[model samples]
Target: MTRQFTGCLLSRQWRDVAGGVAIDLWFATAEEPLCAHVTGEQSVFFLSADQWPQAEVLLAGERGFTSSEPGLRDFSRRPVRALYFPAHRQAREAARRLLEAGLEPLEADLNPADRYLMERFITGAATLEGTVERAGGHLVMRSPRLRPADYRPALRIASIDIETAMAGLELYSIAVHGTGPGGAEERRVFLRGPGTGQAEVQAFPTDREVLTAFLTWLAAFDPDVITGWNVINFDLRFLQRLADRLGVPLKLGRDGRPPHWRPLDDDGERHALQVTGRLVIDGPEWLRAAFYRFESFALDNVAKELLGEGKLLHGPERGEEIGRLFREDRERLVDYNLRDCELVSWILEKTGLIQFCLARSNLTGLAADRSGGSVAAFDFLYLPRLHRRGFVAPVAASTAPDAPGGFVLDSRPGLYRHVLVLDFKSLYPSIIRTFNIDPLGLVLAADPALPEGASVPGFRGVRFAREGHLLPDLIERLWAQRDAAKAADDAPLSQAIKIIMNAFYGVLGSPGCRFFDPRLATSITLRGHEILNRTRDRIEAAGHTVIYGDTDSVFVWIEEAEDDPAAEAVGRELERTLNAWWRETLAAEFSVESRLELEFETHYRRFLMPTVRGSEKGSKKRYAGLVADDNGDDRLVFKGLENVRSDWTRLARQVQEELYGRIFRDEPWQDWLRAEVAAVRAGERDDQLVYRKRLRRRLDDYQRNVPPHVQAARLAV
Candidate 1:
């Protein structure tokens, strides 16, 4: 009996069946997890109809059928026919064959699951219908017709941590901090041996028993999202090895399926994991994608930064301490393990990273667990609209030469007061909107019949149609949505929107994107260059000395600085004048409404624009400033200087901070410098003298002699 159910897509997989491809889509409904099986759907790709004679000869025995009639057309406007295969594997094999035979195959790179849902416009939330049955406490349906549905379900999450030997092969303990149905919090630590701790510790006699018990607990909790710090590369990988040693399955997935692991590279330094019915997101990766920054991504450091607390054992001997606790102090070990787990959970909640992930997925139609797919996100939002505008998606390739980047003006190095910084708000997006710069618009404007004044002229022989463009309108909508998100104080949604909007330029520039043309990227960036230069000119023409400019900001140095309020008034006036100038200028010149907005970003009382080392020429992208805090206390801020560099020693940073602060504040520093030198000579700065440098290349790869870190690694080895 056919039935219908509504839910959000949780996971998807596919396999070859007897008759056709079998697609398994798991959904998270309000009641329970539902498994929908859409069968009898063949994998498909498009080919030009003229190539059918050669294709049939090449794919004679393939388990598929070629359409008798043409269905679609390639970007070149050649009529294309569809080829349906019994399974995804056959379709991929046929595509490879066709490629080897030098025939163009369209839409062959799309995943079957993605193709199916995108064709139906069923992103994330959808309704599934047909042949319903009850299976394993969840509803199961077969051959379901999916329709778009607005299903947003609350997801259960678990933060997992594991303690292991220094070699990272032996399992010491596994701890889970989970929130399940009804928001009930669950905490458990499966220690390998008999122990006692403040945490809820379940002791087992052997590693195998502990592993089995942990798996059981995980199944019982059944979290939709499993997260940890470097969980896949370390903890989960070790657990899987342990399970294999004990001849047991690592059944962490909801449907009794084991976690699948694939090495991200041939070196096996990193790996990615996929759970059958859950999203296993690495906390640090997700946080970085959300633009979170810290001194280090180490759990202890992150926890300390975000939650004002570190691990139970935080010190130089942390690794040795863990082993010692495991031997003599089991309770401490359990506490440490459980604290790590809970810290991950706390960090996730504090940052609202999960919400950001969901918002990103909702906005881009990508899975929540996917990372750094700016190009894919652009395609998901752009391709369908392009097709609707009577254009097929082009193949991924760079069609034009490289383009110049944003304009960075040479700085006038000096220390000055009342320096105001003016910035263009979302400069590239605004330029795109103002100029109607788009791939389709570029094509339309290039028509021979298009009159000279019919389209807006751009840099490098590019012209954009006045109408029938999509990106400008698309970005306008996103811009408004971002404003709404900001108004609602939805940081996650706001950030997601901002990221997506910013990715448009990058997507157009990337050769991996199907829409990539140097013209499209060049238009945006060159337009930016022009705008920044013209704005700087206008500011200079307005009787202000523009000391520095970079990409989208201009630093105006006001002479004989008054007070902070006077400086702020000057900035506001400058901003208003520049905006008015842009509005009138664009209206007069291009006959276009200007979206250019210059915002008053910062007022640095004592700003320093340093020159290049050992040269009189000024630097670009490096500066320092002093600003007053809310309590009227002066704070020294550094950019691209030793004070902010990670590789610099603590002693160097401290000395710079002290020297710069004293100089900026007009305080005497000779006595202080002498005292610091004496302390250094007396070995009082021993701890601060150690240099922490990142080895960006492998030890063996550094054939051009060795750096300090490489030498240290050699000495350690």
Candidate 2:
């Protein structure tokens, strides 16, 4: 029988087959999972027609051969001759050989599977038309023709948590809270033997039985997305190890395939699990990628912060306590396990993290489960469009660029009153919009045929064309969408858009990106330097004392202001005049309408740009201020201070906070300082004196200069 189906592309892979490359795709449909097999697709890349002769000799023994045509053209309008391969391996081999032979191969770095979908504009959603066949008692769509489809199905999600003892490599319990088909809620726990839990618990006779039961339950539930707090590194890894020890095949995939574990390249520090037809999302990683900030990312802490609830035990002995609960209070242990699952699910729902991931994937063609794909996302969105615009992206540069950092002015140190902070809204993105600083524009400006007045002049011998560029328009659209998202109070979507916009310059600067060029990134940043310095000058000339300036903000000191209202008025006036100055300046000089928007960000009633520890020089990025909140309550804000540094002990931070608070409030701080000193001398501050620092490297790797944390880690090990 033949049929048509639509679903989200859950997973995709390709392998070399007998005749050609076979594409294996897994889709999550509303009713059921669909396995599709596509055959006879060849792997391909492009090269210049002149370079084909050398390429043929380089790839002599390769099974795949080049295409019999020279059709595509590159950015320089050079003809991009076609090269095809029978399989992915041959394509990769040919690319390596061509590179070794000093031939430039365009778009050869893309994965075969990705090239297949992205070339056809297929992102996460897909549709298929195929003939049905029976394979090993399961239905398979044979030789399916796939296309990009708009799919927004309600996905089935599972919140999973597991408890185990690391010392013995023992599996204690596997708890899952998920929604089944038809929106039915399912909660179950597969525990090891000797557990007298409630009806939701299924006790297993052995370790192997526990793993088996968990897999069976997972298959039965068949969740589209599995979410957990560190599930990949901890829970799934434990399950895989347990299954290996018991010599049992842990079939966790949608179609009873064993979970494929790919250890991360970070020296086995992280792992990624590929479950066919499902997404495995880690809560902590996903939240971090979405720019979620918390004092602590621990499951209990995050749950308490977000949902007003936390783990069963909030004490420091959680690990020991979980094991204790398992031995003495099995019912309580089961409840705790199930509560964790519920909390993770609730967190995901409240944060709208999944929604943001889907939105980002749809926008950038990245996998929904992928994290930290800033460069990849930028390339995905820009490359296809660039190709259509007659540009083949340049290969990654071998060396890193020496781009100037953001402009930071020398702060006039000392505590002052009524300081107004005026900030340029989205400065780099605004600069791109106004000046048209873009990669393609750089190329266009260099063309001799272009008119002298057709481009805007940039710093360090850079110029951008007046028309037909990519980044400025892309940023403008994203900026508008972000504003809309902010107006609608959609924090996740707003944050995702903000991160993408902010990463454009960085991606261009990064040597890892294919379009990396010093000129492209330097133009944006150096233009920013000019804008900031000139804005400060304009503000200072407007009869206000410019105390300090950073990349996009200027701090103006107003004399004898009694309250926030007066300071705010001064800020608004400065913002208006500076924006007008920039508008007139850019229009008169470059004939480009300014998109620079100077926004009044803060009215600090009492502000302090602190000095270096023992010197009179003011700190670069550290400051503190007193401001009034929306409710008219006075609040103290600290930046780049010991109060915000995690490496500082709690006692030190507390001392700084109390000292600063007293000073800012005009209260006597000498007595408070004396009392703190007395407490420290009397050993009453011992608990707060423990310094906590993150160990960023392996203990063994710290050879020449071992920090205290490294020593501590070594001791612990």
Candidate 3:
């Protein structure tokens, strides 16, 4: 009997079977974990019909390969034919032969497993329909039919941390804290020593025994996600090395398969771990990907910042402390190790990072654990749409013309009161929606066969099709979803949609993306340039003074307004006026409806647009403002200033904040500044004088005239 179920895709892999390649997809459903075996799928790539003659001769004797016309055309409008192979290896080999023979192959580098999902528009969630057979603890689906579905799995997460000797050669203990999905909570530590009387602590006589026990417990618990601070590079890598020395397999996968470890770069200092049916996510990596910024990514620091608690032990001497605890205080060592594991779990829970990851995956069709694949995500969303439009994208260009960036209006520097900030909501996305900017649109618009009114003029002598474009409609859909997410108070989903929607412009602008074209990027940015300039002119004509404008926001001095509410009222009027003007103007001029929306974002009672540090010229991005809260309390906000910069010394930042606050509030500041300088000169503020900066390169790599921080680093080394 056939069964239908929805499951969230956890992992995917492909293997060469007897007759063809079989894609093994593991999923976490509401009921249980399951594996689906999809066979009889061919690995395919496309080639220009004109080049098929030479390609046919090159692959004439190749077995298990066939060629056919699939009614697809390349970006250059040339008819393309698909080359199919029973296995990925065979297809890759044929593509290599064709390349060596000086024939270009299209979409040859795409992974077969990724292609299967992308073509079906399947992201992380899918609905499966097929025959199911129960295995020991899981089920196996044979040749399931899969389609995209909205599903969020309740995954079991294990936060694991290992304590080793200072040199990292000897393992002392391994701690595991499991949460979610499973009914029972798990907190256990396996230490390499005599058993402790504590219920959560288990001790073994040898390192191998401890490792074996930990592995056994882990396999039994079966977490879908294994997380910790730098877990992949430090904990997992150390365990793999120790396991190799102890002649034991590090079976971390649900299928009892060892993780596949691969170096990420030529340096080999960093590695990526792939476990079958499980995700190994490092806490810091995913946090950064979610746009969390911190002074440091140390587990203790992050835990303190996010959870208001930190590790049991902290500081540079933590390693030594662990060692001492291992020899003299095993129980304390176990507690410390377990605390670290718990801290990782707490951090993840506090930030809702797992939910954010799932939301991002649902939007981008990327692996939930994957980070920094904006280009890949773009491909996943765009390629299928392009295919349906009867076109295939060209490979990423090796080189493309650099596109101009956003327009920053020249500032009229001054300290002023009642300055209101107006912002264009999602400016680039709104422009995309208004202009129908798309790769397929750009290509189709250039065809003379297209009707005259169906095309709109773009920058750099390019045109865009008014209809049959995908990006505009896609953005519209996401924009509506984001609105709904906001209304429902789902911050993670809203943030995910925002990040993906904002990434569309950058993806088109980047040469790394297959759909990248200079015309497409410039059309958006140059149009923005036009919009900003015109908006500035209109604002100035309305008797308000425009002090500064950067990219999407404009600062206006409302001279007629005396208080914050009055300034905000003026801002609201301007917003409505400009929005209506844009709608009418775009419809009249470009014969298109405008999605442009200008919003009154903030009202600053006092604002400062500072000049260059040593010049009278107005600075572009540096500014400060005082905003009054609803409670009638004034708060100082800084941008591109020392008070907000991470590299600046605390002394400078504190002084700047105090000085700015006093100046904005019209309070006495001269006496305070003199006293502060005197205190600093007298060594009273010496602790605040130390500059905290991160070194981006090795100390020895600094050659030429080095910066002060680099010099200090070299001296310390």
Best model number under TM-score: 3
TM-scores of the models, in the given order? 0.94, 0.93, 0.97
Model 3 CA lDDT for position 26 = 87
1 versus 3: better lDDT goes to: 3
lDDT of 2: 0.83
Candidate 1: C-alpha RMSD to true structure equals 2.6
In Å, residue 123's CA in model 1 sits off its true spot by 3.9
The sequence of per-residue lDDT tens digits that candidate 1 reaches over residues 1-717 is: 877778777787778889888878888777777888777888877788788889989988765565555445555656677788888888998989998998877767777777777767676678877887887756788777788875556688899999988884678899999976577899899998776845488888899889889888888877888999898888888888888888999998778989878888888877877787787878999999999876578888899989999888876678888998999999888888888988998898899887788777767778778889898877777766776675656668835577778889889998888899999998999999999998888877877788878799887788999898999998999999899989999898899999989889888888888878888898899888888889888888878899999889999998856789988888999999889999999999999999988999988888889999999889988888988888889999888898888778889989999898888888999999999999999999999988777676678888888888889877876
Q: Write one digit per residue (lDDT tens) for candidate 2, span 640-683.
A: 99888878888888888888888988999898799889989999
Off by over 4 Å in 1: 1-8, 48-53, 68-73, 124-132, 141-154, 181-183, 197-199, 398-400, 449-454, 630-633, 696-701
lDDT of 3 by residue, 482-580 (tens): 999899998888999999999999999999988889999999999999999999999999999999999998999999986767888899999999999
Worst 10 residues of 1 by lDDT: 66-75
lDDT of each: 0.84, 0.83, 0.90
lDDT score at residue 57, model 3, on the 0-100 scale: 88
Q: Tell me the lDDT of model 1 at 445.
A: 88
Better of 2 and 3 by TM-score: 3
Ordered by TM-score, highest first, the candidates read 3, 1, 2
Q: After superposition, how far is residue 293 of candidate 1 from its true place, in Å?
A: 1.5
Error of 3 at 663 (Å): 1.9
Best model number under lDDT? 3
